[model samples]
Target: MTLIDDRAPASVARTIAGISNGELSGSTCAPELTEGPWAFDLGMPGYGPGASQGDLLPAGSAAQGELPERYRRASGEELSSWIASAKASLGSRVAVMGHFYQRDEVVQYADFVGDSFQLARAARELPDAEAIVFCGVHFMAETADILTGPSQAVILPNLAAGCSMADMADIDSVEECWAELEARFGTSPDESGRVPVTPVTYMNSSAALKAFCGEHGGIVCTSSNASTVLEWAFERGQRVLFFPDQHLGRNTAKAMGVPLSTMPLWNPAKAGGGLSGEALDASRVILWNGFCSVHKRFTVSQISAARAAHPGVRVIVHPECPMEVVDAADSAGSTDYIVKAIAAAPAGSVFAIGTEINLVQRLAADYPQHEIFCLDSVVCPCSTMYRIHPAYLAWVLEELVAGRVVNQISVPSRVAAGARVALERMLAARPDTTMAA
Candidate 1:
């Protein structure tokens, strides 16, 4: 079915109110919205935001399930009015930070928009802002929470909007893996000299994991600064255990000429099976066996197909893809890099993109003359990111205005101290600190 043809607006609209605030799974709330009208629109490569496309759904109708019981069913005009009122109500006390790949609906409310690391910095820049509404996933809010003061609280509109990539590694699993790594690899202790190993958790991980990194000498890193982070690790330790996403570690290491054999995958399900004799001996950068499902769907076959179908199609992908896929693509970088690459490209060029569907579709719409296509033929998106619906956004902001203040994500003081140490170490070590915003 055509992406537009399959959209059941009534079904999607009804599902909004039906969803529980904190519940994410189909069992808990809206019966796992696996397929819907919005999902259909996502299938259309390069289909942009509703407001951008002039398809803003009619608001404040007599229809019962179209909107919440409390507020007037909002039209584009009403939506605009509510946003203006919210800003007026909060004034400069509330600072909204949007992730680079956020949908236009959420991004529209952002006072500052940037990548993960830049968003962290953005939060610090607004230390005085009493409330920081983060328009990203759970971990991003956690990062903002850690970076900001105790006076401020970080809020996620949809509490369920989490990154599966982050979930792939937890503090428990990581601690277990590290104990095994230390016993097996036997790294010399860090600067404090008591701890045997350095735990370098990616910034895309949970705050608890960051606290673990902080408790140990491990630092947090994003796609933009993984190399600088690794360099710092090498100066301090014999080997670095990188977590959550493997491809990020591999690609970053490869760029620095660390041999593939040196990078071993740590599988949590396997007790001791993860450590091959060669893997332990040959490795410098140990990678956890995890991936971004959204990026994993972008195969070499899709790249080949896009190349054949649209001659001269420039291919780009996130570094979270496997080495073979990164080897095949024309370019690879963070989400911001992908957008900027397309923006700088000549108008006539055909570009095939690999990333989250929303950002790719948004790019295609923005650059209409140039043919832009997703690397995957099958319609798929980052399921975690899909949790942030417009209705949830409106509800969260309204709750803030009502003074109820639901879903405030705060990092524990001990965790924040540890996490801050790691983050500060990263910023100090990095020579060229410029990152995408």
Candidate 2:
């Protein structure tokens, strides 16, 4: 029953929990000891002592306590067998969509696997499926719910799975920022007939913010089509207000020949985002003070080291990374682009990719002829995406088989109406051929 033995199952669980809760230092945890495929099954640890409940749960998350003992105590073999049986029982009535960042165990059960926008589109194609089980984060499920028909039910396997980056740009803070912009810009269209400002939210944002964009004259953008979305925005507005991720905005705008001076960071805590009226007026793209914690961990130093160690290595990174890292890499694009780049390379090519470890490892395994590795040595995955385990997946699927939709993620009619408008605009937006990156 002791939780410290190296070979014991309970000890492995304890180590995972400690690492998640920040109780046990990552340096102290042996990397080799944590190499198992089912290591994420221990579940994300509760926040350490004195941390508020809000810190542990994402905004809009349902009340989910411990997983039932039947699921928690099930062996990997049992869970896999159970999941396969459940899927066989459900048949075509249900379809599971997994993101690129999901664990191999959970991903193995997915009927379709791709990036967020691609998965959202996949949900749209399943018109006959009654239940769409989204094995990604909260916002992604929300997007799926918004895209699918009204009769279709969208379920998030683990209610606790949510994106930390999406939570950063809440509705209230965004509305407040809009008010300040209106005050400074006078709410009037320029001589060319475009408005003073247009809000552009990243795909990794809350549905409420998407609704905000829909209600206003704004639209949504993904990493692949952000530059195109921005071009569409500028045609109708004097300035753009990008949210939930500053790095993508900066790097994309910089590529379009917009200088750094024209792109200013908008700090929500400060009045007028800590910018003078003149500064705000001069800015073309006002980037919100939010970023992906996982992508933020990548640095220029890591890229330099990868190049130094492996000469002539083709370095590719995601746009979510900071400007410095994106600049240093040979090329920067979306998750879909990274996958395609690796797939198209020669068999003997070497690639050092800066993205989630799950995806990098999968690429390495898929393209065994190539030497592929992650830029960072640390074994860090997207903690939120890792929250969805096969145990939870089995639980939800079994519940559905029992005719109970336990963790359905439903966007209210009022919100869905507005959010759909922005999403539709995104679907229609065609990115410029030269600006794919």
Candidate 3:
């Protein structure tokens, strides 16, 4: 599983050779190669900024085809056996955590399966485990690294697994936003004892942005606790600058009765984020120009179609969805909230869920008593999250069993110290008892 090892089987190697020779299309290549840098170099479209290049790949790693093959060619049974054997070999030394949106093959091996925040807490709870193999995306692994003890190593099964939404708000762009805010609204608090703006970042953001929040008097928030976190911000500051996902900020603020006129969009590319000075001055919550691609795909028309086709159907969407879509749905909440809503519904209840397809499909299968389907008919899973294949999971686990740590994600102490402050604030901000969905 070490980066230097040649793990790919002869079949996979030959496939890669074929691809290089222009004899094979990406669709015909091994899934691992097609999903990694190889596909990017071959002019295949990728999901997001870092999908096929940059931070997605390990530092100093060779070409995707030349890199070690952990489980790219393993049969289903072989993968299962390898995973089981690795888990057994590692015993208490390793703990695997999976998000609810993860595929069944990967989730099946998780020691604890839950949302991003829950899984981070799970990592902290497992003090004895030396390694925390996170079967999610890069940001999640970074969060686990921040929360867990220094001795514990957090690993993302696949280096390419990165959140597109999170990548939208980099540290440089956010810092620039902060500078503009400072110039517009002085750094000092007003006579009412509230600062001009409070920086509130969604958990979907990078650790650097989280650190920015911590360094300032800002806080971090999850989908489940966003509203509560925002409420906390307003009390301390005259306005809030929310980042990474504008929809989450907009939806949460809207629910709190914050007027739409006061929530202005901030486009980093444009001067003053494309807002007039008047708009900036009037804004109570400034939303960053970003969104979850998966959630963004959901629309009001999808809701209309669901209602038309399935009479009396309840529509529940994630807050990451566009404001129009969220407004159209019967309810909006986090993935956990959606699960709880379905669990509490009557046996024969029909649900038109607007979120990741994998979660919806799993829910449909889990609750045979009710009818459930994604709002969008087109299969749309989080491309970044879906990057964490079972093959990668098996490879990482097996590597751990061999006492080699690969793809370890460690948040620098300087950054972690600041990020932890914001995360702790969210933890302290008690979430609203009423679930959205």
Candidate 4:
């Protein structure tokens, strides 16, 4: 097992703080990230701070209320001590799962730290826990709610922490797209017994979208299992309509030898997905018009820059990046893939990673024997993931210790039932040892 040093060199949070105080000389993707997330809670309904700060939130999106003044004004040492005491008090009653993109301030308190899907899966291992405090984005908490037992209350440290890419594909838009596709190609299966279209939603989406896939003959896929899920879809459907993250769908399909001509981008803002009738008929994979703000920052030029700086540098990026970036890199896969690659590499190897700044920085610090740096020098992290401040973690954990479940995320039973079908399908389709490359 690879152990990431909890005491890894300066975290993103500390760097941002240092930069804001003029003690550090580096550019942050968003200066707004320097403020506490609560600062945006009342201004407008938006993704608070970080990389996704520029991305617009959907209409009628819920806004978080002001955090208590005590938490906001608490000192770092005070918050850390409070969190430790709360965790010690709660003991086995609660399990905290953190995502790789989360800032180290919050991540250090996590009992289990990994990607969203991996963290949700980890919830299963703590069946006796009364509550799961997920220090990730909203979708991640929803996922844990779906996967864990009903008794395990899944709590999100910050209610405003939401994935912008996931917000791009809503249940209404997906249903509309499905209706259009169904009208174009009726419900009849071909003689080969494959449905006309299979809805495939990335794990980053809302629970409602996962439920939609279950209600339909669709399935759910994580970044690690996207290829396997797509293969499963192809076996049962003539074509696939992948949603929430277009880059993941497109890159995965293209890697599977699906021609670009057969994969069309679906724009929900326009009627009929803004594609011609001929285009729809020819489509094998219909990708939604969505992308991760953080991942989208990476460009081919970054690869060239890294290569120029270090002659034998190995480049690796997450599949959520645009196809061009993935193609330009030495390899592309999930967060786990990048971690495993570094763990397996020679001590003298140089690596340039294209992903969130938090994970890249953590990885670089964890393996000091190798030279690891982020392809994009800008200190941009997943905006939503960055919302989880240590203050919020301390507050939530203290609440849990008091027998109160603050910021608890509970998916509706109806939605969870449908989403479970798709999630179980994803687990079943996962290969024994192989993962997406």
For model 3, residues 327-386, the per-residue Cα lDDT tens digits are 999999988889989999999999999987667877887888999988877543566675
Q: 1-437, model 4: which lDDT tens digit per residue?
A: 01112353478777776787798998887777777777777866578666787898987775677889898888777787898999999999998888888887778888998876577579767789999999888888888889889888999888888889999999999999999999999999999999999999998899999999999988999888889899999999999999989999999899889999999999999988899999999999999999999999999999999999999999999999999999999998889888989999999999999999999988887898999999988887887787778888888889887878889899999999999899889877763235545
Q: State TM-scores per candidate.
A: 0.80, 0.88, 0.87, 0.96
lDDT of 3 at 45: 41
Estimate the lDDT of model 4.
0.86
Pairs that collide in candidate 2 are: none
Clashes of 1: 4
Q: What's the lDDT for residue 84 in model 3?
A: 88
**Which residue pairs collide, candidate 1?**
26-32, 60-73, 199-218, 262-283
Range of the 10 consecutive residues with the lowest summed lDDT in candidate 4: 1-10
- The residue-by-residue lDDT of candidate 2 on 207-317, one tens digit each, is 999999999999999887888899999999998999989999999999988889989999988877898877887999999998886677789999889889999999998
Clashing pairs in 3: 7-69
Which lDDT value does model 1 have at 251?
89
Question: Which residue segments of model 2 deviate by more than 4 Å?
Answer: 1-63, 431-436
Better of 1 and 2 by TM-score: 2
Model 2, 220: alpha-carbon shift in Å?
1.0
In model 3, where is the ten-residue run with the lowest total lDDT? 1-10
The best candidate in terms of lDDT: 4
Measured with C-alpha atoms, the lDDT of residue 409 in candidate 2 is 93
